[model samples]
Target: MKLVAGNMLWTNINKIPNQYNYLNESITCDVLVIGGGISGAIAAYYLTKSGVNTVLVDKNIIGYGSTSGSTSILQYEIDTDLHGLISMIGEKKGVKSFELCKEAVYDIEKIINDLEDDCDFSLTECFYYATKASMVSSLKKEFDARKKHGFHVEFLDKKDAQKRFSFPVEGGIYSKFGAAQIDPYRFTHALIAKAVKNKLKVYENTEITNIYPKEEHVLLETKNHFNIQAKKVIIATGYEGRKYIKEKIVHLLRTFTLVTKPVKNFNGWFHQCIIRDNNDPYTYLRITGDKRIIIGGEDEKVGGINSKMSNLSNDDLVSNKKYELLLNRLKSYFPEIKDIAPEYQFSGLFGVTKDGLPYIGEYKDFPNCYFSLGYGANGILYSILGGQLLRDSILGKDRPELELFRFNR
Candidate 1:
């Protein structure tokens, strides 16, 4: 299924062409990871570092999937509010999820520093601004809940928020920590390079058609009729794995993004902060190092396993409409933008679970098969944490966060 049609951030940075064809014969590995996005790459990296025989495969190049479409805003705040999260899962579990997200942010920072990647990694202050008075109280409640959970957050009134941020806003909550931004494509490519250097085998342009569980190994069938045998398998194919795990709670939502030409004197409104609002189908904005504005939003549920559709395509008009709407919103909010028309426009799909919590851990009844999905726009941070969690699980290490995001309860 094609969620995004045109070239995106991932495609723009993927200049080096490398393709791994389908497996021609049976192959074995200690651990096999499916999908070559940030999650799979990081998972392979960690596993290989632990001396595990790991193999990573993807139908296309690394970052060719949803990773290319990501806006790359790394923030601890989730799309769902803290209070809402508490309502979905118990307060204790909700708080645990919140802490896991915060840790994920730190994990990314440490990874970038260790890898010495030149990706545009920057520490950003994230804000959830209130557009209407009704949302003001809700935002305040979230602020209080977050603080109660030991997070560093401050409530900013309208005047204070306006003074701090260049953008026109009424009030908001500011978190000085657990927020960051990066060029996801570059980060993913760098991680793949590191993984390769660590002796992790990766296969691109090869799609896995079926997976069968055997006595002591799992058999993976590629579209080219090649077979792979591995002791364990990881399904990190994003929304593509909804078919294998029949959970209706997860919804595949389509979102569009556009990057405009760098605005002169656009010293950036939030400085390092990834800006967003507290609104349904929320909108997020951030300025790149080159001074171009990157805006993303307009989420609509298209199709997944529950839908009647058999195949998905990116050539839909709905995606184009959403792209235009996003551009118009950007122009309206920031009139200083020279040209509202974006230099590039693209759409990508993300899976959102009903509880707004990612599902990570072993699949039910599949002893050696694991799955991580429904991370939404927070895939980068979660991918980092998920990789470590998967690695620890394989190494028989204790990871407390696993209880909060395990699949099938």
Candidate 2:
């Protein structure tokens, strides 16, 4: 699959800080992690830190997959709203999912601080606004659902929202201290570098062609005929990991993003909080450390690269058109910002599950193999949870939270 295309902001902004060698001969490890994006990096970091002999490999350079295209908006709020999730999986499991994600945000902060390099990590506030007046009631219900669970949130009416932000919304949920942002590309490389110093083996430009799960261990064969023997394997391959699962748990969604040149002033935007709306295919905006505004949305189901889903009317939904639409929406939201244009724009494929939670445990059929598929808008945060849970699982410890994200569930 073409995971990403167009000029990516992260890859164009920063180059890889460290490099690794490709596999030249046969190798063996206690655990093997495939795909060197943020997911694989997280798995390797936790496993190696726990004294597990681990090896990580990527077909291309690290962070070049979905990580590069990622907007990297870290939030506890899943793509499924709290109210919807409660309806889907009951109140207890639904709230627990958010709690796990909220914890992951801080855990990620700790990981970034522990590393030698700073990846532009910052704590921020998030606003879930209702764009249209019709959505106000349900949005209020969402706010209540969150508050009922003891989350720190404020219900904002139209007047309250306009008082803070320049854009006027009908109403919204204002959440504080449960969101963050980061340079995923830098974070990935920095993590792998630190893990390497602690005995984590990393191989780049090495593609694993076939995976064989045996009685005691798993053997991975590379395209160049090199074999990797491991007691366990982690398929942190993101959306591409779909090839291994029989059931269609993850549906690939095509999303667009536009990053603007740094603006001189953020006049109307208050606190530069991450802004998202209640639209089905919602529009979201975030401010980068460099003062650039990233406006992203317009999700479409992909039938293929050139083909759209049966619903989309236009066959020519090209990048340029999407970029213009995004820019127009930005102007509509915050008319105060001026003379700003996208410095970079791109699209990428990401996996989303029906219930808006990631699949992060061992599949029964693939014994001794774990899958760390963080499939949703909160992929980075879930990757943190995945790393923690998989670490505990490998150490032969039991976690009740693991059942919530199990493959069978």
Candidate 3:
């Protein structure tokens, strides 16, 4: 599908850092990754690190898909709140899910450090506040849950919250750990580049037209009519890979975002940390390393219904009114930032799973094939975990946590 549209902030800011050749000839590998976005790059990197013969391919230019359009806000918190998630699943698994993502955040830092390229990665605090007074009790319960789970967090009431932000907050959770940000486009390219040095093959503009799963291996055919045979395949194509599965796991949605012009001051944006509120369809804001504001929210389901949404493919269904509303919301939050205007406005297609956890494991029908779909707001972080889990799964390691995000679950 058309993963994203409009002037993407990341790709527009970063020079097209790297490029890969399209698959011109048939090839074979131990593992074939069917996507070259951030998730596929990450999964390939992990496989290559383990000395597995891996090849990654994408139908579009690498990192030019949803990766470029991503706001790239990294956090341990699931899109579902802590208390809410605990209520959905059991407390243990829910907490572990968040912890896995927390570990993924550091795993990302370690990857960047090993590459010796920052990719504009940074560690930052995150604030989640309640918009109306009615939400304070629930917000407090969320804060307490985090605190009880040994997370470094502090509860802030309306008085303390107002002291920090330009907007009002009836209550908030200020987390001191496991939050970060990055230029996802740059990071995706960096991972592929490094993996190439370690003998990982990457091909862009290579479309997989058909998949033939055998008892021993799977064969994939590119649109160019070349055949790629592999012992295993990893579908990291985000929501697009749903073509291979019959079960419904996620709903497709488009999120609106805009990056503001650089400002000399943030007004009351405390620490310029990542900020989000308790608004129904929450809005998120964070300061880039370059001093611009990256804010996004106002998600709308594609086709506005489940049955119709499944038919979406490369649909140019972006809304101009959503962008305008998002821009106005940013201004409402920080009205004092003079001359502030969105230099870039964009929308991206994403999938949100019921429990806000990525699907990372083997499927029965797609035997010898695995899915590492990081379908949530914490896409990059989940991708990191997907890489590790898929690698271990391939290596015959037992991971019980996989059940939490199992296809059957």
Candidate 4:
């Protein structure tokens, strides 16, 4: 799949600063991770830390795939709201899901600290607001549900919201202490660099064309006619790994984003909190470390329902139009920020599961292999949780909580 297209801002701001060679010959390892993006890097880091011999391979340069295009908003909220999730899968499981995601945010922070690398990580609050007056009651219900569950949150009415921000919202949930932002491209490189220092072999520009699983081990054949043999394999290839699953669980959706020129004043914006709306195709706003505003959303089925959107030809023109719409939305929300024009813009595919939970465990058909598919807005956080869960599973200490993300579920 063409995971992303057009100009990507993250890659423009950071360089790998280190490089690894492509796979040229056959090799063996305890674990072979396919796809050296954020998910693969996290898996490799944890696997190697547990004294397991691990190797990671990528079709393109490390972190240049969907990870480069990721907005990297680490929020506990999923594409499905809390109330909606409860309606789908009982209250106990729904609450557990949110709690796990909330835990993953801090776990990621700890991983960054353990690596001792600078990845532009920061903790921030979020404002999930209603876009229209009609949506106000639903927003209040969501706020009440969360607060009743003892989560850190506050409900803001239109008057309070307008007094604190440049824009006016009918109502919203002000979540405290459970969201974050990071430079995903930089974090991927930093983790891989640290993993390399600890004997994690990384190969770039190496594509796995075929996988043959044996009774004991799996054999992976590369595009260059080389082979990789491992006791177990991890498919961290994001949406591209959907081919391995017979069950149609995730729907691929293309989302667009634009980054504006740096702004000197954020006077009306409250604490520069991350902002999103209650629309079906909600727009999300965040501030970059360099003070640029990133506005993303306006999602349509990749190809408008049936066709392959990735195969479309006029991607550049479509990206421009999406950027224009995103800018208009941003201005409508915060008209006080003037002279802002997008310096970079891009679109990429993200998988949305029916329950908004990622698939993290092994599948029956694919023996001796684990699938770490982080499919939602909180993909980064899910990857962190998947990495730890899979590490434990491989070590013969599988936790029962992993059942929440089992494939058959």
Best by lDDT: 2
**In model 2, what lDDT does residue 198 have?**
81
Clashes of each: 2, 0, 1, 0
* Residue pairs with backbone overlap in model 3: 2-314
- Tens-digit lDDT track of model 3 for 238-336: 878777788888888878788888878888788889998888688999988889998888887775445333233222344567777888888888877
lDDT per residue (tens digit) for residues 111-212 in model 1:
787674767888778888988877898888999999898999989998887666656676788888888888877787788787777888888888898899
lDDT tens readout by residue for model 4, 24-134: 999999999998899999999998888889999998889998998899999988888899999998898888889888999898888888776768888999999986999
Off by over 4 Å in 3: 304-318
Candidate closer to the true structure by lDDT (higher is better), 1 or 4: 4
> What C-alpha lDDT do the candidate models reach, one value each?
0.78, 0.89, 0.87, 0.88
Q: What is the alpha-carbon lDDT for the whole of candidate 4?
A: 0.88
TM-score of 1: 0.92
Arrange candidates, best TM-score first. Answer: 4, 2, 3, 1
Q: How high is the lDDT of residue 368 in model 3? A: 93
Clash count in backbone of candidate 1: 2
